[model samples]
Target: MKEKNLLKDSSAYYENNDYYEIFSKAEDGESKVVNYLSKIAKDKIVLDAGCGTGKFLQILEDVSSKYIGIDLSFNQLVKAKIKSRKENSIFVNTNLKDTMLCSDSIDLIVSPWVLGTITDLGDRELCLQDLKRVLKPGGKIILIENEEDSEFETLRGHDKDTRTKDYNNWILNNGFKVMERFNTYFKFDSKDEARKCFLEIYGVEVASRVKSELIEHKIVLFEFVK
Candidate 1:
């Protein structure tokens, strides 16, 4: 499928909390991205933009003084609330382009593979502007996104969205510097498990490519300071 149509198709999967949980569990199987974010979030007021099902909530909650997770999907937030075990955690259902957060309130903002889902440049910029608005002076923003030429791109079957060279340039133009590029993989228990999960998220063509229990993935981290 074309990358432009990717976002539209994602809603069906996202709305189903149970199935979405399977994909989320299979992602970043090593917790490398989560560990990196946890280190910088210590003692700060952290905001998770588009914190689907609270994947990073538990760790972020443990380290940060306060944790806020915001997403447009109410069903995702409901699942997130169940995952959150701390009193400091707050889940809000709102759009990323405009949130009900106060200006200069957040000490750190972590957005995991969220902004890139937005196909429009204008919409992505608005989302960034709102993040900047809530960030305190000298605050930090960490964005984890897919890197091109990896197994993830191959599985997706298209390169028109944020994984393209154009989007890489767009990120740099938006004042985000590349912090690190690392290798991670989806480590499933078995080939059948990997096939079933991939089939659900990416379809039959993508699923057929899963020949091993470990599918290599590449991800890049971009950092911006307010």
Candidate 2:
């Protein structure tokens, strides 16, 4: 799908209470991410790329000196605006492939499940390049991507297992060092329950078959520093 159409469809697709409830259940994931970041330092500017509904931004509120969120979905940004009323928090609608943020100005960048949606490998690379350009030297990047060997097959989209691995390597090659890697598994009681939850968050018919396979699947959390 074209990027604009995909963003519009996704915004309309997730405008339901069921989707928000399922997403709220996953808020613990944000906590886990925040805990990991807390060890880094307190005095730093942070950016949450693809900050869907601003769930993770809440976790970073008390930790960072400044927090900014950027996403492509207008609907998601509206939700984020409602949740973040802090003066230091800002949300912008911009694509990661081309950002207006100043170069080498940010101290840390966090992107949970953001990279997986870019269906084009070239665009993914450009996104990474843009991220690198915007990060200061020795700055950290915490990212999470669906695990290749996991049961979540449909989430893989046109980008295959090799592509994800290549993207990981690209981060290292561009000027970042891999500091840590964590593999997390998400569980559901059964295929029906899993399907219900995913449909609510990601829209129905997007990953029905994959939901069945992802009854227990893995995601990778990567901590890197430039």
Candidate 3:
């Protein structure tokens, strides 16, 4: 599918799909990153860039001093708002590439599995610039990205896979150091949800394989400091 179609369909896809829900549950960095920050960000503000549906924001409200989540998809934000208690957390509908945030305002920014969706190099560069711009001195960035192709997306020929290219080089080129890395699997609730969403996105052959093989996905996690 084209970028235009992607832009148009993303809201509906996020609103009606299990893609974010099941995977967010499966993501290790979602909990691990917050736990790591609990001691550091107890009195500091944190930003969740490209925070689709804000599932993690619910956790951050109890941990971080303040939390802000931003995403481009309105439907996704709506879902986030519903999940969010809106106590100390604010959910905004916005793009990560150009977040309208004050300079040097955030103590930590956790952006997981976001770069692959933003396939364009220029746009990603701009996003990196914004991340640097908004981060306070001594701040850290936690990223959860793919170590390999997303099987369903690969079957569909979509560019939603990560780190076979771009990300590591981008981190190095930007003078940011990756402090740590972790590997984990993106597992689902059951074979049924996996089969349904897989069929919706990848089709019969992939879904059948997933159902039969009990295939859990591979994810790479990173922590960056500037």
Candidate 4:
């Protein structure tokens, strides 16, 4: 499948009410990500890459000076618009590999739970480069990826251990400093519950395998300073 098409399909799969409700509840890592960003992003121009349905963007509305959400899915953006009524917030339908925003224009870049599913390493690198280009000196990039032992292994069909170190190395090589690297896990009531949510959002077989690997579902949040 084409890269863009894969993204679109993924978005469509998560576009259902079940997934949206799961996200809205902040039952996953969304709340933790939002809380961390809100603490450090006060009065800054924030860019939310792959800002699906503006869930994290909504959390930054009051905390950030300005917020721009960019995602590849128009349907997700539509849902975001319905959820957030803030006129100051802008949601743009654009690929992260190529953003319309200019260079050195943003203060903070936040990407939550996005890097893992982007199987195209080149596209992921391009997106990071675009983020770096648009960020001002001394800016920050808050990225969240799935923990190596998390359910995300099945969702993305890739292991985090394979490319996570390289991703961090790339950030350091590109002039960003890693400030904090920690593993955070979220627990569901049962494997079945987790599997159901995963299946509704991703697919069936993947969800089944992911559930089998669940000791406790979790993700890793990486905070970088540029």
Candidate 5:
């Protein structure tokens, strides 16, 4: 019943035999962020706030004019460094809520799967403020977050995607605009992997009914023009 410190780093799970077995090939959620960032990151200085395992490192570095990946996890940053080869791409270990970057210095700031940690709109506002501080005026910030989840996400600990309605209200109140929305997946190569993931996240009874097929993951994108 022990839980991984998701906030600590992906390597924790990546190293765990059981956790890794279940999730090793569990999903392609990262592609959604990379796909979007790759399109607009050309020759732009892009910031990946929660760049887990440096998943976006290769593509962003190739497409971006300059890329900076930051995360609180030292382990994750290590992996990021290994994936990046260009002098233009660098990884920093720092908290997204606050950073040392100078004001209006970055051209593009992309934060994906980070805000879901904030359960409160007020708290989310503070996070946005920090990103806003460094973002150049009229620059773009693309935010990716999970929508309301169903019971299928049972094994998840406190990390279930925050309620969608609350997030929607927060966006509306803050005057951010939706640029795109879509349904994606946490895909598994096989049923066994899916079953293990379900069991690890939800437990035995929940895993019992989990189909081998990929599970649907709903995501929304918000584009804030500063």
Candidate 6:
């Protein structure tokens, strides 16, 4: 696969909620990403852009006064709604590039593993602009993206999302700062389950590399204060 195509392919997989939910369940089983977000998101109005399956909603809802989860996929949103527990939770089927939200409304925005899949640089910029439009002054936007040379990246057979130099440069030029680099893993109940899950989500080529139940994933966190 070409470096650029991997993200597009991965993004398409989310349209199928069944496979996507399974993939989401197997990822970051240790709550590394959630733990990191909890420290920064307390008592704020949080928007989870491209929330998909609401994997982080439970934790995000626990911290935010009001929580909004938006995605372009209604099927994904349907799955997200099932995971929502609090009265403050809202799920919207909307695109990130143009969310019809009030100006200067949100206190924090979380875009996890979502923007890089946009593929078009122009669209990514538009998405950022819209995110800025809704963000309160001094409010923060946090992004979680794949970092280079992870075992997961090797399996994907490409480096676009994982290689941070160019991606990080684009983010920096847009006024975001690197917050941290961390390690997480996709943990499965068994090697057989891992193989089956990877095969369904990543295809046979990538799935063939699943030698164990735990696959190391490295990610970088970016923060923008508007």
> Which prediction has the highest lDDT against the true structure?
6
Q: What are the RMSDs of all candidates, in order?
A: 2.2, 4.8, 4.1, 4.4, 4.2, 2.4
Candidate 2 lDDT by residue in tens digits, 128-171: 78988899998877786545564443353423437556666665
Clashing pairs in 4: none
Whole-model lDDT, model 1: 0.82
Candidate 4: 10-residue stretch with minimal lDDT:
1-10
* Over 4 Å off, model 4: 1-26, 151-178, 181-193, 209-215
Q: Candidates' lDDT values, in order?
A: 0.82, 0.65, 0.65, 0.66, 0.68, 0.84
Off by over 4 Å in 3: 1-19, 29-34, 37-40, 149-163, 203-205, 212-214
Count of clashes, each model:
0, 0, 0, 0, 4, 0
For each candidate, give its TM-score against the true structure: 0.92, 0.72, 0.77, 0.75, 0.77, 0.91
Report model 1's TM-score to 2 decimal places. 0.92
Predict model 4's lDDT versus the native: 0.66
Candidate 5: give the clashing pairs.
43-65, 138-226, 155-201, 155-202
Clashing pairs in 2: none
Per-residue CA lDDT of model 6 for 1-226, tens digit only, reads 3222445744455776376677788888788888988888899999999998888898899988999999888888888898888986888888788899999999999998888878788888999999999999999999888777788888776564434557767887889998988889988889888887877766787778789999899888999999
lDDT of 1 by residue, 126-209 (tens): 999999899999999998887887877777764545456677778888889999887898888898988887776666778887
Residue-by-residue lDDT tens digits, candidate 3, 75-190: 77777778776586888788777898998889988886675556677887898789878998888777766544555334434445444446655655667555555444445667
TM-score: model 4 vs. ground truth: 0.75
Error of 5 at 142 (Å): 0.8
Candidate 5 lDDT tens digits, 1-226: 4443343433344334244333524555447656876788888888887676665577778988888898766776776688788986778787676778888988888876676555555655776788888899888888776556632344343235545566665765665788887677777878787887777744576667667557766677788888
CA shift of 195, model 3, Å: 1.7
In candidate 6, where is summed lDDT lowest over 10 consecutive residues? 1-10
- Tell me the spans in candidate 2 whose CA falls farther than 4 Å from its real position: 1-21, 27-31, 151-177, 187-193, 200-217
Q: What is the lDDT of residue 57 in candidate 5?
A: 71
